[model samples]
Target: MAARSSHLSLALLLVMAVGCAAQDYDFFYLVLQWPGSYCDTRQSCCYPKSGKPAADFGIHGLWPNRDDGSYPQNCNPDAAFDPSKVSDLLSELRANWPTLACPTNDGLRFWGHEWEKHGTCAANAFNEHGYFQTALRLRDQLNVLDALTSGGVSPDGGYYTLGQIKDAIKRGTGFEPYVECNRDESGNTQLYQLYFCVDTAGDRFIDCPVLPRGRACSNRIEFPAF
Candidate 1:
């Protein structure tokens, strides 16, 4: 009887260790891919914006509105453009929860800018990596929300707090947390950060792209649920 009890204790210990190992693996993977997981850039100054002549905008960057300004000269066939990919972000929210009623407004609201609209919105508003990053954060957070509703573990590996979803963007996981955004040093819009969260009291939206500097719009994101 004594030996059986000892064996049972050892088995429980082994099971706990395995669980810990799995959690560590998931947490670290998120840390390493933190940046690439959630950000993208656009070609704003690369093409001259209207009113500003092509020469004034220069050739190094894109400026949104020039007829003959700098663009991907000799566009490659392999990298065709498409916008349907990101349009669903809005649609999904509408479909999943009908009463939310967040409008597909006239112009895009890119935070900080306070209601900037795209004259002609493109197919890929969320950018390349934004797809995976938003998906992962949303999925993980949804899991947490579900567990909370059902009364289970938070799935932060028991490390992050309930509010850490927003905090994690700047400080990351497995480290002493600290606030990192809220400035305009690198052309990153601080408002875009809101969209990246997995869950929020408000409607969810993905972080839009800021050309030249990726993740600059991290603060501008909306946490829409669909």
Candidate 2:
């Protein structure tokens, strides 16, 4: 009887550990990247089987981060991303968050990686469906391409100051954004990714408690066409 009691206690501890692991973050970062800069570089990218993605930015992830700029990743091994859990959202995901990795696929691998590394860390606030749907909804809410275009910062391979880009996004979303840059083949710095801070609920954009430690962009950078 005593041995059975010991086993029960051990099981309870494991459950507590998993719970703690999942709830250990403060906020979410919805990161979106320009497919143009992704594919136009020396390191080429392949389009997903779902076909070419829109000219706009595609989701990189919705990462769980803390105010200190730290983050949690792969918190639950047992909570591997099951594609079936987000089956209903597959179509929408394919259009909006499609993968551009070499040797193209249906993009299950990209979503799976995000789930295990980031989504699992936020299990307290979201299950699989909730997590994925939240990303899609956030992307829908903040149309970066449209925002930039409306502000005359169109991605016609045009040059714009870093401040101009951030202001455009702020005007569109009612909150500022952090712009990340990457070099293309010619070594010219160009816009790469955009980061937005989401509430703990993953519902609305808020002023970032702390921006990510991303690479520096010049005062002027290109918004290259995809």
Candidate 3:
């Protein structure tokens, strides 16, 4: 009896060790949107059914625009993400934050799905937090709109009080624009860039590959919501 108990304890310890190590090497990238117009439910896992706040953009998976020079097809949400086997890394990566919160009981179905398919949400929580760093850059565009009613703010400092923030995106001040990642001509991972410039007249325009928001701002600020 004593020997059996000792063996059981050893097995339990080994299992615990394995679980911890699994989480350590697990590097995940949240995809804000999948290719085309569909959200890959198999890869979205950050938020549950509680309904994400207006400001939260779960995770946008990797965008492959530069890879084939053409947008990729939508992902099949039922695809699996392997937690074990390092060799399956890429496959799992294709579904990092897998979810089952959609109204459809079949597969990839959830609230964030719609926003992500359109490249509206953040690629991950980290990306969302980064946007807040330079709140001022977006404040001019994000402020006036009633996030719940108005889609968002207008570019000319005009307020919209009855639409979705996605719609309000048209009102952006163009300081910190969205970014697009793809491979370069040299076949290397490259980040396309876009910057904000305050002209002599104090005007800004949306430019090239936008950088991750709040990353360039030297000052840090907190965004409560919207």
Candidate 4:
């Protein structure tokens, strides 16, 4: 009986060790892109064959990030992106995650890149379908445009303080989001993206340990008109 008990304890230890060694990210960065800002810099933005996306911020990507400002990508080579797996989500994806690359691009290519680079890394927590479904659900839950507009921030070429933007998002979502911006042709800082950190479960929001590299924004930023 003592030998059997020892074997069971060893087995449990092995299981725990394997769990700890798993390829898991620290958190998820739910990134949203401002179409207006992107088009202003690029001079032109292409839409998928479906149609132009709504003026609202679109999903840039759902990335897996680490605590040290670095992130994992293309984690599983074998888990290649399969478009058929997410066929049911194409409508929502086209509406929310449209490709804005220049010279026109397909949603499938954008999804493939996202899946190969980021989705594969998050495979332990979510399969391809769950990874995308969670993003769409979260986008519906967190309304960045409404949050800013309600807080007196509009896209009519108005300059806002970074503190104001963060405060507004916190008031709307009960959590502060990491704000990112880029400079316009006139050298004014404009809101480019917003990233909210999510736990590995891809369910709840969490405070980011460190922001993404080179995502610093000035104290006052502009929200360009679409």
Best by TM-score: 2
Q: What is the TM-score of each candidate against the true structure?
A: 0.20, 0.90, 0.23, 0.89
Please state the error at residue 110 of candidate 1 in Å: 5.2
Score each candidate by Cα lDDT.
0.26, 0.90, 0.30, 0.86
lDDT of 3 by residue, 1-226 (tens): 9999999999999999766533231121112321211222223224334333233222333232211223322233332222232232323222332333445332234313432331222222223223222222333333322331243232221222222232343454312334233332333222222223221111233332323332221111111122
Q: Using lDDT, rank the candidates from best to worst.
A: 2, 4, 3, 1
Candidate 1 versus the native: TM-score? Answer: 0.20
lDDT of 3 at 38: 22
Model 2: weakest 10-residue lDDT segment is 18-27
Estimate, for each residue in 156-223, the C-alpha lDDT of model 2 and write its tens digit: 88899998998888887787888999988998889999999998889788889998998889988988
- Weakest lDDT window of 10 consecutive positions for candidate 1: 54-63
Query: What are the runs in model 2 whose C-alpha is more than 4 Å off?
Result: 1-23
lDDT of 4 at 1: 100
Against the true structure, candidate 3 has what lDDT?
0.30
Question: In terms of lDDT, which candidate is strongest?
Answer: 2
